[model samples]
Target: MTAATQPLLPEGFRELEPYVVDWALPTRQERYDMRLSKDMTELGVFYDAIAPRAEAAIAHLDTLDLDALPEPELRLLRLLFSMILVSYAVNVFEQPSIPDAGAAFFDTLVEPAV
Candidate 1:
């Protein structure tokens, strides 16, 4: 199966995956647009729904050596981390700027070779 179509983690992270039913990442413009609803209630609901999968992803991530993953898997891992950071910023910290939070989160990650 192609990387996008492949099951990265069976029975986990299905809801938060890109193109999934619950996937939502605000664009840089959206972050600055406070006129839009940045309600945590909806984000909380989605986070609660995906908590199990997020935990599972955390557990699975612990098992892998990041530097050893292939290019495609590394990209997938980045996606997972991006989702987690966005959720943390919006839900936990109630941060209004997704782009800033994303930049902060990724800034700390050690880049592995593609």
Candidate 2:
């Protein structure tokens, strides 16, 4: 595919996009389970597989000038950040009594003014 039609995320990372469909306005569980889910080994595999892709993707991202990225690429970057941030949250916060609190906080900060 030409660059215009190519997937915005770095190759393997594109598969992770669906989980972040509403990253801008995700429910608590959506945010909380962004990594592994105890009942879904497939998701667990996906979570496990993403680390290398994330490292490569972030390396690619660092090479770009954010202000100059095409709109689609920028949106893809936002999704990439969401994945990284959710992983970080789980590590730092563990399972919280309020699963969605972080999602709500992020929606306020990141969601467009629509």
Candidate 3:
């Protein structure tokens, strides 16, 4: 909580091998469900900060493939991600207040919050 040192996305996402920056893809469905979803009891705190429309969009989202989701969901995902980034821009970068199942994915230190 002092310095706030958790990375935002994955190492490859920040660095990238390929196709990582595409906004037309949904993040992994399980990961997305874990971080968001009010109907689901996990209710990650980061989920609390998301735009309500994005949350609704995510819930009804239909999967296209592992590499992609429907365009509507993908767009909503981008909006959700933008909200998260904004918080990191304004607040400290700490572990996303997700459930234990979700937090395990991000371990590297994020850059200092602005």
RMSD of 1: 7.0
| Candidate number achieving the greatest lDDT relative to the actual structure | 2
Flag clash pairs in model 1: none
Query: Which scores higher on lDDT, 1 or 3?
Result: 1
Cα lDDT, model 1, residue 78: 50
Candidate 2 wrong stretches, greater than 4 Å = 1-12, 24-49, 96-114
Superposition error at 104 for model 2 (Å): 12
Model 2 lDDT per residue over 1-114, tens place: 787676644555667555444442233345445443322343334345555576766677677786587544565565555555555534454532235565354333454321
Residue pairs clashing, model 2: 28-100
* TM-scores for all predictions: 0.41, 0.47, 0.30
Q: How high is the CA lDDT of each candidate model?
A: 0.48, 0.50, 0.38
CA lDDT, candidate 3, residue 87: 46
The C-alpha stretches of model 1 lying farther than 4 A from their native spots are: 2-4, 8-11, 19-42, 70-76, 91-95, 98-114
Model 3 stretches with alpha carbons more than 4 Å out:
1-50, 62-66, 93-114
* Model 2 vs. true fold: TM: 0.47
lDDT, candidate 1, 1-114, per-residue tens: 686777543344444444332243233232224212546665555445555565666577667786686443444455454456457656556753553444453232333352
